[model samples]
Target: MSQQSVIQIALIEDDEIVRLAISQRLQLAGYDVIECADGESALSLIPTGFPGIVISDVRLPDISGLALLPQLLANNPEMPVILMTGHGDINMAVNALRDGAFDFLEKPFDPDKLIETVGCAIEKRQLQLGANKREEYLQQAQGLDQILIGSSPGMVELRQQLVKIANIDTNVIIYGDTGCGKELVADCLHKVSTRSQGNFVALNCAAIPEALFESELFGHEAGAFTGAIKKRIGKLEYADKGTLFLDEIESMPLNMQIKMLRILQEKLIVRVGGNKSIAIDVRVIAAAKESLKDNQGFRQDLFYRLNVAQLYLPPLRERGEDILLLFEHYVNLANIHAKPLSGLDEKTLLAYGWPGNVRELINVATRFGLDASLTVADILVTKPLASIDSSASELSLAMQTQNFERKVIAEALRTHKGSIIEVMDILDLPRRTLNQKMQKYDLHRADYI
Candidate 1:
C-alpha cells in the first residue's frame, strides 16, 4: 500500500522475538506497525479511535489480551482486535471472540493468513469511517439540532424521506405508537420547511372538551359563546403561513371533524359569531397513535384529505442498536457521570422491548445518571402483556411458526448467556443466518446475558 493508504497495526506481545517477527512481516506487507511489549503500554499508546486494528497475544505479562479486549472495544466499538493464542488455549481465544474480539489466530500461524485477515479488517474499518464521515457531513448540512439520533436502516430512510418532503406543501399524517416522538418529527418537518419563519401551533384534540372544540380550533368573536369575553384567535389562524400540528386526531369529536374538514377544503375559516370569511395559508400535520381506517368515530373523507403524505415512525424496539446510541445521547444531555456499558448492562439494554419507545428510554437514562448503583432491573419497568386467548388455533400457521422460531432463539440465547458460538452450535445455525434472524426479531446477544 502507498504511504497515505497504509493501514496501521498495533502489535502487543511480551515476547520480544515474536513481536519483532510479526512487526517485520506486517511492515514488509506495507503496513505501519506499532509494537508494544505489554497490554499496559498498548493501552497508553493506542488511544481511543486509533486509526487501525490490534494484534495482541492472549497471554501478556502485565494484563491478558482477553482482559484488554473490553477496554479496546469500549474506546471504539468499531475497532477490530485480533488475538493470538497457543494451540492449548484455543478455547480461551474463542471465548475472547465471543466477548467482542474481532478474530483470533493460532500459534505458528501462516504469515500470509495473518496478512489476509488484517487486510479484511482494515477494509471493514475504512468503510465504517467513510460512513461516519458521511453522517457527519449530513448532520452539518441539515443542522445538528434537527438530526435524529439513529443509524438503523429505518432511521436512515426516514431522514431521507423527511428531506424529500420538507420543501413540499402537501399535508402529512404521522402514524406511530404512543411516546414514539411523533411530535418531534412534526417539529422537524416545520423547521425544515419554507414556513420555518412562522409560528408552529400545536394542540391535542383529546385534551380539549367537546363543548369548546370549535372555539378552541377556529377561535370565536367576543360574546360568541357563554365564556367568550374577548376576541380570540383560533389555532388555525394563529398558524397562518405556518404549520399546525394536531396530536391524537383520532380523539377529535365526530362533529368537529366535519368542521375541520370544511376548513381544510375551503382554505378559509369563519370565526364563530362572525359572517366574514378569512383566507388562511397553513400546512397541517396530524399525528395519531391508532389507525384511523374503518373507525366509525373518524370521518373517512377527512382522513383521505390529510393522509396525502404519510410518515410511519418505527418503535424503539425495532430500531436495533439505536437503543444504545439513544441511551448514551440522553446520558450526555443529563450531564451525569456514567461509565461505558458492558456485561449484563449491555445485554439488558439490547434485549428489552421498549414498549414506551424513546420516551421511556430517556427516563431510564436519566435514572441511570442519577443513581450510580442502579441495576438493569431498577431501570426496566416491564409492561404487562395484553391478555391473549389460550387457543393456538386462533393464530395462522405462519404466525405460529414465527413465534416458535423466536422462542427457540430466545431460549438458546438464555442458555448460552450471550455466547454467539455456543448459541450457534446449539441452534445449528450459520453465523450469517443467525444474525439475520436476531435482527429481524430485534434480538441482541448482549441483552440475553
Candidate 2:
C-alpha cells in the first residue's frame, strides 16, 4: 500500500513557518496533509473520523491544546493526537501522554524524528480502526453485543449480569423505569436460555383489569363466566417449558397476587371453573418500575419466587455518551431521508433529562429520520411540528384569535430562547398580560429554554 494514498496527517500550529515545515515534511514522506493555523481552525477543519493523525503545538493562540484534545477525542477516541512541546513544557507533554496523547515532540527535533513518530502513530491508528470495524461487523453478525447496545459502564455491567443469569433456569425480576427496556432484557434472557425452542409468552399485568386478571392469567373454561364462551390456555400453560414475561407486575391486584403465588408454589395451574389441574414447567420473568422489596402491597413470598435472579436496566440519562450512540443506532435502523445528526444535536440530547427514556429516544429518532427539515430542538419541543389550518374556517373568531395569540407568543419565546424581556418587547404586552397568556396556554419559559 502507498503511504501517500492511505495515510493522512493534520498539522495544527499557529506559527506559519513551523506548520508549513511539518506539512511539507509529511507530504514529502508520502502522506496526505491537512494544515490549520490555530486550535479553533483545527477543530472545525478536522472532520469527525478524519482518516489521519493530529500533530498540534502545545501552545495555541486560542484554546489550550490540552483542553482541545478532549473535544477532538470525543468524536473519535482512537484517532491518535501528538503534541509538539517546547523544552520547558516537557512535564506538561508527559501528562498529555498519560491523558491520551499518542506521542510528544520537543522543539527543534530532527526532521527524521518527526517522520519516525508519525509512522508509529499511523501503524497504531490503522490497527485500532481495523479492530473497531471487525467488532462492528461481528456485532452485526448476531453477537451478544448486537442485542444489548450501549458501551457505558452501566450497560457493560448489565450485559455481564444478563449473560450469567441466562444460563440459570431460575425466575428473574427486572427493575427499571418505564420504557428503559425491561422487556428487551427479558427477551434477551429467553433467547439465550435452555428452552429457546419453546414459546415465549408476555402479559402486561397492568393492562388487564382486576376483574379480568383471573381469566387473562389462569384462562377460563367454556361457560366459566358470563363472557366465557370456550376453554382457553393461560400464559403459564402456553409458556410451558419456555419463558413467560410478566410486565408491570406491580399493577397486579392483591387477590391475583395470591393466586399467582399459589400457582408458582404448586408449579401448576387449574383453569377457572375447571376441575382438572395442569402441570406447568416454565421460567417466569417479571418486570416492574418499582422495587418489589419496597412495594408494600406486593407479597414477599411471590417476590422471592420470581426474584431468584434480578437485572437493573439503567435509564438513558445515566448512560453518558451512550445517549448519542443509541440515537445514531435508531436513526440508522430507521434508514429514512434525514440529515445526519450534528455535534450540537448530540449536546441538546445529552442535556435534557429523558423522562420517557428509550421509548422517547426511539420516537425522536424515527421522527427525525422521516422528516428532513425538523431539528432536534423541534422534536424535543412540546408543540406540534405542523399545524393544520383546515379547521380555521369552522372555529369562531374568538377561538381563532386565541390560537393566533398563543402561536405568536410561542414563536417569540422559541426565537428569543425564553427571554421574557425580548418576548414582551416584541409582543407589546405588559408583564402581567404576557404572564396570563402564558399561564392560559400552559406554556412555560423553561420548556422553550
Candidate 3:
C-alpha cells in the first residue's frame, strides 16, 4: 500500500505557503494529509472522516481558531488538537493549552519538533481506540444471544432441537465435555423458551461444597444453621416460575439426589431445618460431561427423570467447517481490542486441533489482539494438529473398524467441502455406510454446501 493510504492527519492553516509546507512535511513523513485553509472547511470534514489529530492556526479568516478547539474536542474527545500561533501570540497559545489543546507550536518552529509532537498525538489516538475496542469485546462476550457461529452439522441440529424444545417445559439433560459450551446451550434454552421473561438461575453442582449444597439449593428458615441469622430463600424459591440450570448435575451426591428427586416429584422444598414445605413451580435444566451409562456415581432413577429430553453437545473437532465461522466472529471481536485487526491464514487455522473447544478459541484470539506483532506460528504453537493417519490406525480392528471407516469418510466430506455423495464416490463406500458415517460424525451436507 502507498504511504498516503496509511496514516491520516488533518491540517487547518490559513497561510497558503505555511499550510502547503506543513502538509508536504506530513506527507513525506508517511501521513495522508487533509488540508483545510480555514475553520469552516475543517468543520465540514469532521462528520465525514474525523482525523486522528488536528493542527489548526490560532488566527483563521472564517472563525476564531481558539473557539474551534473546544468544538472539535467536544465532538471527538479522543482527538488531539495542536495549536499553531505567531511569535507575539505566546500567551494565547498558553491559554489554548490549558483548554485541552495537545500542544502549541509557535510559527517558524523546528521541523523535527513538529514531527515529534504529531507522532505523540497519533500514538495517543491509537491507544484510545484500543481501549474502546476492549470495552466492545466485553459487551459482546456477555451477550446471551443465539448467534450460532458454527458451520458444523451437529451445531445446526443442536440449534434446531433447541427451537422445538424451547417451547415446552420438559426437563432437559445436556451432555458434553468440559469447555464444549454446555452452559451456553443451557442459556440459549432459557432465552428462547416461553418463560424467557422469568429469571434464569444457574448453580454449578460441582463448584459448591457438599456440606452447603443442601442449604444452597433448599434454603433455610431463621435460626436454622450456624450462619442462618435470618430467613434465607433457596434457588428453587427464587427461580419460581422460571428456569433453574443445574450444571454438572452428575457431581450431585446420592443423598442430595434423593432429596432432589423428592422435590421434583412433590414440587415442594423442605428447608434444611424448617418443617414448612414451600411450593415451587420451576423447570430444571441439567448438564453433565459424561453419558448416563458412563456415570458411576449418579443415581439411575434421577438420570431417567432428568433425561426426559436430552441434548448431546459435540466437541469442537467434530464440528468441521464451523471452526471458520467461529474464528471470524472472534477476530471481529478482537479487532475492537487490538490495533490493526489481523485475519487468520489457512495454514494457521488447519495446523491446530483445538483441545479446549470454544473457550480456547476465545483465549487465543484475545492474546493475538494484545500483541499484534505476533505471527500465526507464535500464537498457535502450543496446540499442534493431530495426524489423520494416526487416528485411522488407532481404531479397533473389528466391526468397530466400521465406525473408524465412517469417521474417515465424514472427514473426507469435510475436506471436499461437504459433498456427501461425492465423498462416498471418492471413498468407494456404499451409500448405506456413508449415510451411517455422516450421522455418526454429525456431518450434515447442508451445512457444507
Candidate 4:
C-alpha cells in the first residue's frame, strides 16, 4: 500500500519491553505504529480517526484495558481493539472479547500470531472505511437535495445506477415493494436528465378507471365522445420533451396495453378519436410492486419494451441502519425536535419487519413527531412482551435459554455499570460462572460504565 493508504496501529502497553517489542514487530510488518505506555496516554494520543486497530495490555498502569475499550468504541465503533492478557487472566481476556475486543492475545504469545491478528483486523477496518468513503462520494455526486437518503450498500449501488441511467433517454422499469420510494427514484431520473426543465407527469395506472384509460393516456379531440366537450392533451403528450411516470403499470387494462406498446414502439400516438398521429419526445419510467414477468395479466411485449432499464429497490427491513436514518429524516421534516432514540427504542425498530417499507416508517415517524407522549409501543407492530415471546418460540430450547441468559446478564451489567460484584449479586451467579456467561455474550462492564 502507498504511504497515504498505510494502516496505523496504536500499541498501548505499560510494560516498556513488551510495547517496544510489539511496536517493532508491527513496524517491520509494514504497519505505522503509534506507541503509548499507558491507557491514559493512549486515550489522548489515539484520536477518533486513528485509522487502525488498537493493541493494549489488560493491566494498564493508569486504567484497565477493559475500561479503555468502551471509550475507544464510543469514539469509533468500527475501530478494532485487541487485548493482551497475562497468565491466569484468560477470563479477563475472554470478557474483553465479549465487550467488543476484536481479538485477544494471551502473553507469552507468539509474535507471528500478533502480526497475523493485526493484519486481519487492519483489512477489515480498511474495507469498512472504504465503504464509508464510497457512500460519501456517491452522496456528494448526487447532491444533498436528492430524494434517496441512505448510506446502506444497497442504497449506494442504487444511487450509482440511477446516475448512470438518468443521462440516458430510455424507458426504465422500477421493481420495489409498496412505499419503497419507487416514485422518488423516477423523479430523480427525471431531475438529472436533459428533460429536467420539462414537466414530470405522473399517473397511477391502477387509480384510473378502465373506460377513461384511453383518453387519460392518449387524449381526445373536441366532441370526440359524449363527454369530450374540449380538446385535451393526455398524459403522454403533456409529458412531451420530459418524462412520464406510470406507477402500478401492471394494473393497466389489457386493451390499453396494446396502445401503450404501440406508442413506445413507434414513438408516436393517435388521439382517442382523431387519426392525426403526434410524435412524442417523452421518456417513460414505469414502476410495479411485483415482477411483471410473473404477473399473468401483464403483456410480455409491453414488459420487455418498458424494461430497457430496471432498478430493484430493497425494502426498509433490508436497508439495515437506514431505517433509523430515514426515521430521523422524516422526524426533522415534521419539524419536531426529538432526542436520540433510546436503546430499547432502537432495538424495537430494528426487530420489526416493516412490511409497508419506507412508507410505513414515514407514517410512524410523523405520528411520533406529532404526539409528545409517543412510546415505542405507539409505533411498533408488536408489543414488547409479545415480541419477546414470538422470538423465544422461534428458537430451540437451548438457544432460547442462552438468549434469555444473555439478556439478563446484559441488563445486570447495564444496571450496575459493569460492576462484577453487583452484577453477580443481582443475578445470583458465582464469580466464575458470571465471568463465563459475560464472555459468552461478549458483554463488557466498561460499556455500561
Instruction: For candidate 4, write residues 354-388 as lDDT tens digits.
Output: 76688878887887777644544345533344433
Q: lDDT by residue for model 3 over 1-449, one digit each (tens)? A: 44235447889999999999999998888888899999989987876336467899888998877899988888887688888878537578669867888777888889887987787667656545543544454446433322655535787788888888998888999988777898889888898898788889999999999999988999989899788999888898888888999998888988999999888888999887899888998889999888875477888888888888988889776776455446546765777555432122333444456667778767776676666555334555434445222432122233234434545665687678887668878899886456544543334576555
- Runs in model 1 deviating more than 4 A are 1-146, 381-449
lDDT of 2 by residue, 309-414 (tens): 8899998889986777677678767864456564335556676577778887899888878875455655665434242123321234454455566668888999
Per-residue lDDT for 1-449 in model 1, tens only? 35325457899999999999999998888888899999989999988878788999989998878889998888889888899977437578658768987678888999988987787677656545644553464445445233576777887887778878889998999988888898889989999899999989999998999988888888899999888899999999999999999999999999989999998999999898888899999999999987888878899999999988888889887987677767766765675466444323444666666666888788888777666545444355322234222231133444445545766887789888989899999889998568656644446787778
User: How high is the CA lDDT of each candidate model?
Assistant: 0.78, 0.79, 0.73, 0.79
Q: For each candidate, what TM-score against the reference?
A: 0.61, 0.60, 0.53, 0.61
Which of candidates 2 and 4 reaches a greater TM-score? Answer: 4
Residue 412 Cα positional deviation in candidate 3, in Å, after optimal superposition: 38
Reference-based TM-score, model 1: 0.61
Better of 2 and 3 by TM-score: 2
Clash pairs for candidate 2: none
